[model samples]
Target: MGDVGSVGLGSLGHPLLGAVVSLASGGGVLLSGRLSLATHEWLADHAVHGVMLLPGTAFVELVVRAGDQVGCGRVEELVIEAPLIVPEKGGVHLQVEVGEADASGFREVSVYSREEADGDGAAWVRHAHGVLGSAVPSSETQYDFGVWPPVGAELVDVSGEYVRAAENGLEYGPVFQGLRRAWRRDGEVFAEVGLPEGERERAGQFGLHPALFDAALHALGVSGALAGGSGSLLPFSWRGFALEAVGATSLRVRLASVGAGSDAVSVLVGDESGRGVASVESLVLRPVDADQLNAVGGAARDGLFRVEWVDAPGAVAAGGEVASRTEVVRVVSEGPDVVGEVYGRVLEVLERVRAWVADEDLAGERLVVVTRGAVDAGDGVEDMAGAAVWGLVRSAQSENPGRLVLVDTDDVEGVGGVLPGVLALGEEQVVVRSGVVRVPRLGRVRVSGEVSGGFGSGAVLVTGGTGVLGGVVSRHLVVRHGVSRLVLLSRRGAEAEGAAELRAELEGAGAEVVIAACDAADGEALAGVLSGLPEGFALSGVVHAAGVLDDGLLTSLTRERVEPVLRAKVDAAWNLHELTAGMDLSAFVLFSSATGVLGGAGQSNYAAANVFLDGLASWRRAQGCRVCRWRGVCGPRPVA
Candidate 1:
């Protein structure tokens, strides 16, 4: 196939585009390039806060060059989402994609790149997306720069121009310092920019060399318009950009405000002889900080972590072992591990915890809850029932600190030697791996792949939907995840405070809202709510946010205090799990707690209830059931 317009790949191709190939599946072109300080040495001179960045002008140049490749020479619109940081030692691979023209003769264009060191399988980071229009001729008014420093324009001091930029984190080296002089008149700023002698020789290779193009924009700072709030500003969005002429070593640039109180500006570019070179209808800039630039490539690697088991020994004095108390009460997991016996096992642990906590006579003694293979500490979980027991005791321990201890062993015999040492170590949660005691620790993890948090098209069910946390989750589902259909369940339903207003707000945002009064802990009530969903709005996700707290010290607790908390957390979660087991669900998120995992003082019942959720999630995963496929979201409230 012939190359589009005057754009081609090798000798006749652009210096930035390494290859241009028509996509096999789609009728469009995909342009690929490799960028590096070593390959593009000029890029090394353009550093922000000592961190090198691919200038936004480079994206414009790349996009325009791509437009030429597809016969779409006009950039109708472009928005830069994230910065592309080039590492000091390695390089980055980039792609410019142009889709087939639509009925309006416009094509969708996007720019993506990834670190070259991350290998071929690394996820591409999307930097910019925009539209490309037909390569039609324009009749926009052009400015005349033939007369040196035109009639009424006043010259602005350019002595401290580069110094001020450097103070704002823009470190421009020789090649990038293209602003020779600037002028101002009637709220409009005009400037003259040109490439260095060495770089000028290669200026014909690009539509407009990024350094020169960037220097032209730097003149905007003369009016303090582009000097962003708190940090330096950079171009974020561009519209109506058309390259009239290429290979211009020197440019006369005009910068005019789009409107009153608007930071956006219009630009007109011309060669040194005053001939029109390019025009931008409007360009808006956004403030950028050092962190954002440094963390650009971290999206694929962010939000990633893993649990590690680290050895923690007792704090023994020099040449002496820590004294271990001889008196220790042991509570073992006696629940059956039958796949269908989750609730039964949970109830047994609940009763045991209640009895243990209520025993004021034994309050002076430390109760050690021992289980085998309850935690995934180096080895896979063997006993799900025991894991559930661990959850229950964790809460009880939290309510009565120093009164309870948790130990998970690989075998019953392994606990004999490690039990005293575990107690002596002062670690509340310990797992015996091959007779060595180890505790859980969280560690950071980095992976190479795009992170997507989008939800599919369907209805999402949120329990306790009228409560504070539930209301927050409902709004997030509709606003952030684009959940169009929501079924909210609460005891009072619409009668709950702000429930009616929330429904209206969600409905205003194009989501169909259903607020029904139902007790999630009541299996039959929950079933009725699910069955009553309007047709075509099938449930695809569930957020079990319903929870009740009746916190108290173990000595002040009773069945009444524990039952309601369990019903809301334990029973409700189990009911949802059993009810949704056969149904296909994309997510079954149980809003559990950190208190359940690490135990919280005075919240034993609530903690135990949460731990049951942890076990249930594990059980469901083992059964290949969809409940809790993703870990539960834990927080008292969502950040604004």
Candidate 2:
């Protein structure tokens, strides 16, 4: 980590190499620059999950420049520690320090960047470090790549390389799509990669051009490392990243697998003439988690709650101290007039629970939302808040590996009746009555089971039909379920951002699509829409898919944030239930999320809203109505 030797940069011709700092006794040279989106606009295009980042080629270019200055034509290796993030308005000051050479003639190289403050206020952060070595002349026979595609190599189309990379969480924009061709041979991957036509002429100005070198790394696309087609991986470390030749616009690359026990992969970068240009002796790749990366990347997310959902302690006797990290929502009776106050208290406590779990392991923890009232048995609407909690937590659990556990009991203090089974985290939901815990289980695997179908040719009204998931279901109903008429309702309807496109697509698919901009939460508004259905529309099916999100850990849940979300979910679902009760509908599908069943951190109200859907669905079924509670949880969102 010592400072590099100071020198002058008047002699270097590359614009990227701003100034020379010093030369070490062993002939290693240091360089510095002021990099920004202003100087290099193309760097602004490459991103990993909304975060604008300097490409890995930038590091390779720096080391290559250092190799030239220090009289060393080889770059041994470079290990990236932190990413160099270019800020919004200003550029980042950089330092490329090449260490003193060793007896075998290899120099250590490092890159650091920091924002520019008034004076010495900015702290320099090291992004990468590695070695720069001397390239000794070798007469060893180079692999015969002169013949047009190798004999045993199987040709593979790489036209959609960037798209494939994105499926694995690596979002490569146009600038970084460098893979041109790939061929898999006997245990070896061969490919030809080139830079964009616009940037090709500028490749020869630097020590080892970035776009050209970037194309070489892109050739790694055919490596088995990315064959799984899952998560994204970045180049993390390399033990020997040595460069031999200077500039090559298009690189013919050979990527070979290493021994069984090694973490490194062997690669060679050469030109069409079969001359070795650069070599990755041993490169190590690192996997990047998508959710975690988006959470910490770029600017910090704005919200008061930064809590995580931690699991609960095992079954403990009633009156015994429960684990503080456990997500324990103790439901108390709210005076009919004090609905807002009760919601405020719930939000406050949940925030603390979320923050506490930030440092704890949630794998085996249980989120016990304890409702202090009779578990609503679907006879009437009661304990709406308790139902909402189930909705919110169930939604959260789906993202956090299913950690939600719902318990309803009149006795909050004396849980001796439910302790053993409730504490174990095995049941989805349980009710405590007379010292016994009653767990509710799914009756059967209903998927693919015979559905009671009869709405093969009538109009079906769908609440929140403009949403991403709603649009999907709308199509399925028309194409698979044979619904000829449709009513798509949302607060925006045709005015929602993507509503027009959705309407066009569904209409093109042949079913009538109606965009109703009515709020489902308002009983009067929803009632009017249902009564105003056009003639010939039977309204045989009702699908409620509307919901809103106002997320906060339980602690930060205020009435203001809680009301809007609940109105969209609870009120909307209730209105739909009441309006569709007397109709002869074949299906009353309520779109509920796993959050109602699993409990999500920061989604106290969202979870509660979904819980209402579950309760209402059950209530309708009790009245001899056919209702389907679709327990749907969206894909993972970052933890609070």
Candidate 3:
């Protein structure tokens, strides 16, 4: 990065990163390359929620590579736009475009990717963008250390940090485990993370080595643990982030609390010379799990929700450690009564999260709504509303990686103790009862065991029957399950485009099919439909297969996006629950998805809605009511 007055586009010859196509200088450079699992298979190891994605660090590597060609010596700032999902077959075409230097002699850099299309043309999408500048500090803002290991600083043991991180799916190899020494001075953290002798010499080749850079963040973990941070923490965004030097074997990292009102920390990195090497105005960490990262494509199930439940022998979470950097808010009160009130509180809490994430970045944080007198209360409004929370937060967690730690506890002291481990574990939820932290797991127990003889002329009500999955189910019920009488309920029942075709298909299977257009979310309308069922066609089986997908990342989601999804899943389920409770139905099957059991990214609101159904099923079972659980998946045709 020092005076590279003229380094033309020579062959990159990087074995893993691929070759650079060109590097022309207009005080900057533009290069193109082809990437694939064949060339960068190691990258597949870096995944979130079981998805093989391009890591955020890879973007930083591009900026460093760009700075090495230009005279610029550092990456001033970088912001990730969208994630790049590596394809299973074809390669991804990449472009690194650097613009001419600006007023302050800083060049803008961008990284773009377009997956090899199977049919239609695919446009280039920018994944990450940032700025590159000179290595010298524009203004020297000196920081006084006074002396090494300042007085009153607590010496924290960071020896086993990486191993624990690996257990939680971080899997930082030896190359990235850069913590050498650390100390907690007052509320500020001071640490040194040095690279191994083997990696130091190569540091001069690039503006900054990702290994060294990543290691520097180890202090943040220790600092977070000291301050009450738990679980796996991922960097969500960078603010005024800048690198001041080209090569540094070790960094003196200093992190101090921003203020009492915020969970952020101001980060300052210095070299052995005591000069600034890098500075981050503020940094935020979010709680994450394996399931939150991998919902893209069809490979979301099977491996996504791989959970391990650990039973603690002690009452309190050992030492009850938490990351000083993480934002943990404890909702100590018994929550509101109505579902509307709960949702209002949800929006209010989300607003606070939005502010913490601020700008375009997804916030990395945690919320613990601990209630003491709710459990075993037999489906009270407070408990039911709280059950809805598990779904809502789990869905949000999927969209925003490492962003939540949900804990329900009756024990008051267990609150602080379980946080560190829960935050560290990144499991969607854990309940602290009987002096143990119980991590929950989603398992598929076959609800339909050998469909015992047909419906025996009893009429079956199928909600969302006009939809693709519903039509298929209706036909299946008639042909295979011996269901002779069918009542299909959909918002656009007979008026839907494919409604007649579906009815014909079901009727062809030798069953009497009745179509009704009803909004299941409206209890009154639903009750009216149930009461007016054709005489002699008694409602025996109820299959609630209704749902809608209005997708958005948690960062972009709001009440507008969440309500429609909830009405179909949560509210509609509630209506069905109330209306059908008195009836002696053979099956009360609720059509659920992997997202409901395993929260998927971009379906935060949907996930929450589906989870409510699951909770309702359990609640009904506890009340001695018969509730059936049947799940099926259906794919759609390509949009014209």
Q: Pick the candidate with the highest lDDT.
A: 1
> Tens-digit lDDT track for model 2 on 131-194?
6777656632256657657787999888877777777767776556777888887767888877
TM-score of the candidate numbered 2?
Answer: 0.45
Q: Return the candidate ranking by lDDT, descending.
A: 1, 2, 3
* Clash pairs for candidate 1: 395-604
Query: Against the hidden true structure, what lDDT does model 3 obtain?
Result: 0.64
Q: Rate the local accuracy (lDDT) of all candidates.
A: 0.74, 0.64, 0.64
- Candidate 1 positional error at 294, Å: 11
Listed per candidate, the RMSD to the true structure in angstroms reads: 10.0, 22.3, 27.0
Query: What TM-score would each prediction reach against the true structure?
Result: 0.55, 0.45, 0.46
Q: Give the poorly placed runs of model 1, Cα more than 4 Å off.
A: 1-304, 310-365, 378-389, 392-403, 410-418, 421-426, 433-438, 450-458, 475-482, 552-556, 627-640
Which stretch of 10 consecutive residues in model 2 shows the poorest summed lDDT? 631-640
lDDT of 3 by residue, 1-640 (tens): 2233344444553332444433444455666677788875545555544456676656776766766566664666665545677786788887777778888888777787766762225446666666777765564435654356656788989888776666666666455678888888777888888777866776775455666766776676675533225565655444456666667887777887555534446677777767777776655445566555554332321223333345543443455667775655544335443456445545655665555555444345454545442332232223555555555566666755565666767666657766776566556566766556776644333211112222334788888989988887775565335478888989987998889877765564356888999989888888988899888778877788999889887778778887888888777778888787777676677876667556677776776666666666656666666565444321111111
The CA lDDT at 140 in model 2 is 27
- Candidate 1 local lDDT, 1-640, one digit each (tens): 2464334443325767778877765558888888888889999889888888889999999999888877889988787767888888988888988888888889878888888787887667778877899755864337776776867989989889889989999899999999989888887888999899999988988889889999889898787653232358788878789998888899999998775545568889988777888998878777788877666657544545666788775532223322343333343454443333444555665666567656777665666777776677645566655665676677667666776777887767446655666776776787876666687777776543222333346788889998888877886675445578999999999999989777876675457988999998898998988888899678778888989988876556666876787779767887787787666577778887777776666776676677667666665555555544233322112111
- On the 0 to 100 scale, the lDDT of residue 247 in model 1 is 89
